[model samples]
Target: MLAIINDDLAGAGRPESIFISWLLWQPRGVDLASEALKEVQKLARYEKVDPDIARLKALFASLAGSDRSMH
Candidate 1:
């Protein structure tokens, strides 16, 4: 499942590529889903501002709010 998403992300390009990078670089034992959520939050907070990424941040924020497993 994750491999499929990673392939789709690689094909799609840009911000998704960033997500793939994050997914690959996470420390051992970190939860992949939670780390992905944190990566989305960090992208909006620390990276150069991108309107498209800001929109993605909004969506991720909503998902994180509802998904207690991410916390």
Candidate 2:
């Protein structure tokens, strides 16, 4: 499933590619997910802001504070 999504993301544009990058990082663990979120936030500054980005940032922020392990 990840491989399939990665293949699709290869051709994706801008913010979609950035968001997909975070999706790919998610299952690895909280550390990676946090790192990916930071990268997303940083990259988002250079691109036109999207409402979905804010939503995703909020989602990631909540996940970061959760005690549940991703694995």
Candidate 3:
């Protein structure tokens, strides 16, 4: 998790790609990114922002550790 977050914050595109690769390799770790995406999207709207845009932004922020609260 930390590694992925770090990669994202570093603006490395590989983490996102690598995550999918990890899924292909392990095939069972629960690719939690999807759920994370949904939850963060909800948070965005709950915070009174546009849900779709906020969701994407938050997901990117998440991948990049731009969001400080994911931990």
Candidate 4:
């Protein structure tokens, strides 16, 4: 499943890549947070609005916060 998402991510555009990153993060949690964050940053660079982007941002933030608390 993750390998499939990574393959899709490699060919996806900014928005689609961001969505794919979120999919990559779902089962993996903090391990994939940086990948998702990179995608989010790429999307932010375009100054575009995506209905699902906010959810991705929230998910990354939530994961980051949890990851930090673990250390």
Clashes of each: 0, 0, 2, 0
Evaluate residue 53 in candidate 3 and report its C-alpha lDDT on the 0 to 100 scale. 39
Select the stronger candidate by lDDT from 1 and 3.
1
Model 2: weakest 10-residue lDDT segment is 1-10
lDDT of 1 by residue, 1-71 (tens): 12213255345434445445545676999766565577555655633455556544444555455332222
lDDT of 2 by residue, 7-59 (tens): 45455533355456656756644585566446445534533365644444454
Clash-forming residue pairs, model 1 = none
CA deviation > 4 Å runs, candidate 4: 1-30, 46-48, 66-71
lDDT of each: 0.49, 0.47, 0.46, 0.46
Which candidate has the highest lDDT of all? 1
Q: Estimated TM-score per prediction?
A: 0.41, 0.34, 0.28, 0.33
Q: Per-residue lDDT for 1-71 in model 4, tens only?
A: 11222345455544346555657556644456565456445434332365454444555445455422111
Per-residue lDDT of 46 in model 3: 43
TM for candidate 2 is 0.34
RMSD of 4: 8.9
The better candidate by lDDT, 2 or 3, is 2
- Clash pairs, model 2 backbone: none
Error of 3 at 35 (Å): 1.2
Model 2 Cα RMSD, 1 decimal: 8.6
Whose TM-score is greatest here?
A: 1
